[model samples]
Target chain A: MSNLPNVPFLKFIYKPKNELEKGGRTEIPAPRQSSEPERRCPNCYKSVPLSKISANMSMCGCGYHFRMTARQRISLICDTFEELWPGVVSNDPLGFPGYVKKLDTVKVASGELEAVVCGKAEIDSQPCCVFIMESYFMMGSMGSAVGEKITRLFEYATMNRLPVVGFTVSGGARMQEGLLSLMQMAKTSGAVRRHSEAGLFYLTVLTDPTMGGVTASFAMEGDIIIAEPGAMVGFAGPRVIEQTTGKTLPKGFQLAESLLEHGFVDAIIPRPEQKEKIGKLLMMNKAVN
Target chain B: MANPKYKSAYEIVKTARSGQRPTGIDMINGCFTDFIELHGDRYFSDDRAIIGGLALLYDIPVTVIAIEKGHTLKERTEHGFGAPQPEGYRKALRLMRQAEKFKRPIICFVDTSGAYCGIDAEERGQGSAIAANLYEMIGLKVPIISVFIGEGGSGGALALAVADKVWMLENAVYSVISPEGCASIIWKDIKKAETAAEYLKMTAYDALELGVADEIISENGLGGDEFYTMLKDKLKAAADELTAFDGLADARYKRFRKFGSYDEITIETEEHK
Candidate 1:
């Protein structure tokens, strides 16, 4: 309706901040130190610590039991357990050279088939398709497979009346595939569009590393975007920013807290409290049914 | 990110370029032809995110696709925050195709985080436009060259950068994903971006090593005239070099033909249930 200038009003703050980076999370290192908080119920006051918490069962603390990894997050929210159908597993549609081997290797090591797992699932007993990015899978860097799965997932989510919940954890697009990998940003974002047109809610949970392609598209497209506490989200990283610009980023530059300060992240939830938070959000949207 | 030890990204590129910020439109001060600025995807409206048309650098004819970051706040809104919507890419494709039809060489200046991630852009088919670019650029029968003059990011940058000769300023980065995205995915903490950047290998040097980028131009300074001078000369040389191929159009087309691919073998079953 109005004439605009010819400039990219926005530039990729290449290394925009995400959460996990700034939460003072000192790595316990492999063979995690005893000082670390073990698997205790995230919500309950019981101090058993997390080490003993069942991976599938809800935390005794907050009565919220759900899968934790990026892959699990998707299945838990998007798929029906008995009929969870994952879309195209990590396949190198790009043939970007050595990308196949890299995918295989990453798959073998991470135990997740691909960077993203998408398919039919039930939320609050409502059958809806879901797309979860396995952070474990190549750090959830979107290759053609990830993109295709997500694109299809959105298509399916909109086709069905079920609200779309994307438990996203990604490093961005897959670099091994080069240009093809970069193209996923459009493919996946396109799916987000059709899904949004139906007026069905699309909930984007910005897990760790939800930057680059993931953030640039669906993560930003969510009707409501919820981030986990201390999660990292941004386009570029601190070291690269440091190396490129020769500046030390602020103490909490890429942290979720920092993003909240910048009006980037809507809210930050701890892992243990995620299920309840998700359940509540789903219920609020349930009135649409 | 105001670390004192190193020059800013703008400074680094300016320094490397011999002290000129190679921003869109600004570099023309030294010497450049004022090409007609085309607008819109011919759909809803022309996006200011992309500025394309016939231009001359040092009297040599060229088709230029400059990512407009918008000069003013109002301009940014019209262009979808300077992130090209599908229309921008469509317009770019139109211009690129035009250049190919006339056998004119194309020069693209990329500096966007990604395609427009806004509501309207999607409704109008941003994805399709980007996809069309991917499909077309690879098979374009013209000598196409792209430079990450500022920030080469996501699908928006890739749409124009599917070129025979891709270049990045010393400080420019061409990455499959951003470090923040990577850190968030791997560590669930955006703070781990520094560690992730190293792992993702998202730098000009990395792209060069991977054969994704053809060359890395070392700018002479952080910001001044020398950089622009070098840029024009180098760009001119690249144009000349591409022109010398004789079968440059065919070569460019073949280069793109080798681009899109899926697996040749069947996928195996996985155990990560």
Candidate 2:
């Protein structure tokens, strides 16, 4: 427990021990274990040991970039992340079926209050506000809580006049919240506009499967938009599009490389070098300002 | 009576979707003069679904952006059934920004079934493009007047309609989702689209009642000279009112910020009760 990052603080907030037996929800599922030490690379189709992949920061030999959790991404990109608004929790406004239960389950499963975790951090000694959406948490769906947190983060960045670096990964708006979820698109976009109006720099790092309402709003409003290699960035998912149009899509459609070619994304940066590249950009922006 | 109340949602829907109805092109041609059409998003191919350009609205230099539903079958196919692609939204934003730079008022005609739902559209970031338009438009210093001339469906319409003043024609309908889509999602039957349309409350009159739209212009059955005259008058009045405001950007931002409603309920404990 002591070895776990921010575990003590999270335990204090959740009161897991006391609430677990009373509600029968205290059990945290253990991490999955593999039968073998090696796993096949989806891109290269080559057997690679999990240890080697972890050592390489989850990059395959054939340039396939494995998705990372928000916590893992923050640790890799920032020297230290001081979390903001950690106590903020979702009110589950609509009381949609199983919504609160799902939130609790995801909270325990992902060790996050919501899909997004945002705060101030330093990349290569350059300070900036970092918000990372964890795909494991409800597929990084944007609900009222997630939207509010992001808006507040942008407000904080604006007030402090700091650069903002956001790593976005989502399936889109949370359908459980109904129109409240959809409204987040406007709310977050409004926040981004205010941030931009202040002349602060914003960089969006699009990760695997950034789609739906998330793609429409703040994700596309960045001054410089970057994406991970092979990351799927788009509005509607390919399956929906295929079903709607009844046409087979071209190979590598909606991939980051394709977006870059279309001039939608500024560049595709690998996970390992992302910190250095972003830090350099920040420094350049700082000099100009 | 030039302003006849619609009998049913189905009737209004049918009229709005009819081929004989005046489109964005017709409105531009009828209401504005010396119109010069702009092209391309500069990042991708030009989307013909959204037609925009600089034009003179009664001698006032204004930027005109409209969602064009082509009249001919080939033109409709080319325009993606009046649904905008990512480039279409991007092109709108590009033109809107240009309007801002030149201190020109913007007049947009909302007449889309919805945003395009194609593989290439999604791949290029359709949602992002639309959202970008919404964001940028709110901060634009120039006055913006958006009129829903036909079917204003979903977020696709909202992308262009986030203006200082939002108006709708008598027969137009603006809703979060299409009637068929709502019916299929809720009742699992596309046949219930008429019922769903009623439930959605998307008519221009309903929009005005809900405060979602500022006003609804009365279009007589003639659909020619009278309709154009009313539309032009409304556009001039809206543009004039917006131009007189000192803080257009702030007003625009505040207008969108105050959009929905919610209620708070408190629970009492047994002891308190």
Candidate 3:
């Protein structure tokens, strides 16, 4: 302890990567870049080649599903996609400290203007409105732009009498936007309800780490809700729950398997089989125009 | 208790969470007569955190739902300190749907720190329950009004608050996250909560300015008969006005849809290129 106190620079050098508060910045290391040939799997710890992982829908050989970008997920599921409202961008409404800088950084890193990508697409010849949340963009936080895009998409779907498919992977509402981000929960849910009332099918595919406000809103408002294998889907994050309850959580407490056991999620579909499963459901529930 | 004419946002937050404040049961008993309390969500056990039932709002029938934080410690424990579980929300929804069946207006009293963060709540689909309310409430044909009598905490409060009109007491606070939680997360210190409260825009006046709430009820003679009587008059007036309007669902939809604030960027992208 005396030697550690003497080494002043050691504290800075030994800081943990996941610790966001110690560092003034909230920037996480960008997910596997294209330049990197192989990336270490968080689950299996095997360094898998990028091309092999991409070919396997970003899943490691050990069955750990890597988080895919919005575009990447779109390409996998949508046979034909026409992007909608690509020009919408977020503003620092609250003028929150460092918000614009954080947005810029994430925009460059994620190569997306916002966390969610909404578009009209076809899944196995069935037409639908689709939205894929970008996990790389601020951990898929629902800011104003994200909320507006999804709400607009749902409105469009309702008007067109089209089925809607949403893939949610969010940490929660973007706190930088303050209460506006929280209001998105009600906004998106209102749109979803309108779409549902129009007699259109809405299916939500909850990806890993779908928690907080998003979970408490449109992500859980689907007519049929499914989840990716081992996805964490809950209103409160496990850590927050543990802190509040002051009790140790069991293993895989909020995982998709656990949700399925508790009758929350309809099914836990693996990434590779998702397209077929979703396509079949879409095909079955085709709205009679 | 000192009733300051000018309370800071943090002070209002503190006051909203005070134990002496009128709970849901107290409000229900005060505002309405012949209240018949409804129990259970049918799918699960009745949650004590939420008190919902049918009541006569002056002469008109209305469904009343509120998140009750009990006055006594034993009562608080029974009510889970006003933090609702999934079943509590489900029970509220059940009463709401019943109100819709009878073409009755709905009035909700919101007071909660947030949803219950427990293993059982998660297992029972707390997220889904709140989401369901938001979805269903928007499309409900009847007029709905939510009054924030105390702390309107996050999604738990929002579950019962997707109303045509939202009101907040002068001392009440509605926030995305608690000031203390925000401080601890952002500053790594809980002592910065006062500053966090200022930035959060959680006060009733702030809520009105931000368009999150329509009106701010005064706290004059708070918890007294006159306070409840004035609130009842306002509730009746608002509900009557809302009931007269057509296309309520669409209005409610627009109310929430217009909440987002963002800028448009016409930069050359892959699509344009």
Candidate 4:
């Protein structure tokens, strides 16, 4: 190891690009009054009007699913939702360079102080604690704030003796927070264990791109685990696996369908039937506790 | 002031990754007696990346588990460079549960870049396996301690590290992500890994300050008999103290519960402030 003097460690923490704020996704420009905007499905390669897709719960005509915001998820699944801990936010405890600015940028872009939105909600009159992760917010990265909110949500549910319904999507532990972010995995798992030991139910719905630290924690700890169709759920990202193993990936590798076949996911629930299915499951579990 | 021996955090990262450093098997062989090797997750094949079994810590019976990266090239390949598959984690948990049943303390040595990233491993539910370990290990009802002997990488290292006391060697580095990966993802340049390492604060000293690690063991006589004896003594002391305690599971939960750093902002709290 070369002993170099004055390594500019601070400079290495670069300010995140604008694209990263939207979880590395390019937004579709608003359509002109003359014609409605259409989004081309990545899987099927067919263009459909944004309104049509929205009416179908963000699924394309060809069965391709698009990521939804946390609020959109809540509106679709919850009949009545009273949010909890809306004011909780991150403290940038590590003081990592560019973290505060990145958080500020992501906050404005996603309209969320953190990646997860926690609340008490009712689905078909079945009450449960719910947390929906915001894919638009730094890719639903699990940092101190995200972890704390989820832990508190579980603790609250435990105290109230209510079941939990969680929607998970994440790149992994937030690198900006470093090891503190890694610790969140253990912390959240501990809380999840306590909640389960209290005989409370946990239903986890893994959304698209649920990988890394989040997958290795509460996302897979659910008593009954399900996934959205085409959701990529795995501990390692596909690219990382391919790079490390030097092997060509099979079609549909790490997809929700693959996980279902492998017995990790109980079912692949589409957006339209998700509410009815989840409500029924919750109601069925209601008799157990 | 920064430590004079390590001018940069990246230097510590390199040292921690060095092949010449003592591996997990070496520590197990040198520190304990009557080591009987255990294998297999029962639900699946045994993973070579993690080795665990019953061992005697001085005169006390204990269960020891370690992620072994091996010393030589062939051995490293056999151990998959210490990156455990889901089965390895399951095997470790099996041993942990067995230890609890037998009323023996549990000890783990972790040194891994991360968990195995392959199609077979993923097919076997790597994420669920690790998640199960974290959730189950918390309420094991036994004295558990984990020591980071080398690189502690993300969730993989964390699976076995949810213990009453988490110790790290002076040179060990633990982070949410490897510096190289962070550099490539954040900076779009792998060569800036040194800078990323510096900013990550992954060294043992950083872990101590961040409250991630409970203590750091000096590597003054690393790989030597004296070093093994000292580590054994420390392990015995921790085990004795932990075994005598009540409510072990609750104490372990509290140990991890205090990790995160964030402030809750609400109207009443803001007014009080």
The TM-scores, one per candidate, come to 0.51, 0.76, 0.91, 0.92
* Candidate 1 runs further than 4 Å off: A1-50, A53-67, A74-79, A82-87, A91-98, A286-289, B1-260, B263-273
TM-score of chain B of each: 0.81, 0.93, 0.96, 0.96
Give Cα distance to truth, residue A11, candidate 4, Å: 78
Question: Order of all candidates by TM-score, from best down to worst?
Answer: 4, 3, 2, 1
Residue pairs of candidate 3 with colliding backbone atoms: none
Docking outcome class, model 1: incorrect
Give the number of the best model, judged by lDDT: 4
Worst 10 residues of 3 chain B by lDDT: B264-273
- Output the worst ten-in-a-row residue range by lDDT, candidate 2 chain B: B264-273
Residues forming the 10-long window of minimal summed lDDT in candidate 4 chain B: B264-273
lDDT of 4 by residue, A1-289 (tens): 2222345783365444565443343353444633988888999888888988899899998888899989988999999998888887887877777889998999999988899999999997899999999999999999988998999999999999999999999998999999999999999999999999898899999999899899999999999999999999999999989999999999999999999999999999999999999999998887355
- What residue pairs are clashing in model 4? none
| Model 4 root-mean-square deviation | 14.5
What TM value does the first chain of each candidate achieve?
Answer: 0.72, 0.85, 0.85, 0.87
lDDT of 1 by residue, B1-273 (tens): 111256442343233223124555554434356677776666566777787888787778888887766446576555554477777888898988888888788888887766765433433445446655665665566778898866666667887887879888767765565556656754679877665555554567656665567788775673467777788888888888887777664465444333323432344543433
lDDT of each: 0.63, 0.80, 0.89, 0.91
Q: Best TM-score goes to which candidate?
A: 4
